[model samples]
Target: MYHVHLPKLEQMGLIEPSGNWYDIRRGPRFDEIEPLLRVIDDHRKKLPGDVL
Candidate 1:
């Protein structure tokens, strides 16, 4: 995840990484996906059991 997922998410502006490996924060574009996240959270029980 450090080499692949994190970098990809950073590139997408979805997350901001601090200097420390375990420290991270929301990126500028987090708002762009917040609605989708809210929708998913609202319907999480209806999703496939393993989806989350």
Candidate 2:
């Protein structure tokens, strides 16, 4: 799955990868969506279990 998604994310400037490491540090796209992601995480944490 890394092979499939990492390149697409990199192409979209959402992430950067070097060797075996993925850089998910704050960036333009990440900054835009981080709040939404945090909201989703908070919601998931509120769930009972097995939300995925």
Candidate 3:
């Protein structure tokens, strides 16, 4: 589920924990998740640079 995936991302510091919100963590770029991110990028055409 989406909820389960988020905590895993947080644990990896790919995303940070805000006040009950998930703010993306610093550095470590989405290229780290190229296979997955690429699939997503293909669907969306673009991903917000602010997050990746």
Candidate 4:
């Protein structure tokens, strides 16, 4: 899963890996989608796993 998403994220300046860890600190691209991500996260938490 990491390999699948890494290239696109790197292209968008959203992650920088060092050693074995991925750095997910704030970046311009991430900022642009943070609000939407937060909304989705909140919604996800409210839903039951069976419904999901």
> What is the lDDT of every predicted structure here?
0.90, 0.67, 0.63, 0.67
Worst 10 residues of 4 by lDDT: 19-28
Q: Which stretches of candidate 4 lie over 4 Å from their true place?
A: 20-24, 45-52
lDDT of 2: 0.67
For model 1 the TM-score comes to 0.85
The lDDT of model 3 is 0.63
Say which prediction, candidate 2 or candidate 4, comes out ahead on TM-score. 2
* Clash-forming residue pairs, model 2: none
TM-score of 2: 0.58
State the number of backbone clashes in model 3: 0
The candidate maximizing lDDT is 1
**Which parts of model 2 are misplaced by more than 4 Å?**
21-28, 45-52
For candidate 1, write residues 1-52 as lDDT tens digits: 4477888889999999998648999999999999999999999999988898
Q: 2 or 3: which has the higher lDDT?
A: 2
- Among these predictions, the greatest TM-score belongs to 1
- Candidate 3 on 5-51: residue-level lDDT in tens? 77777777576666665554443554577788668867664656655
TM per prediction: 0.85, 0.58, 0.40, 0.58
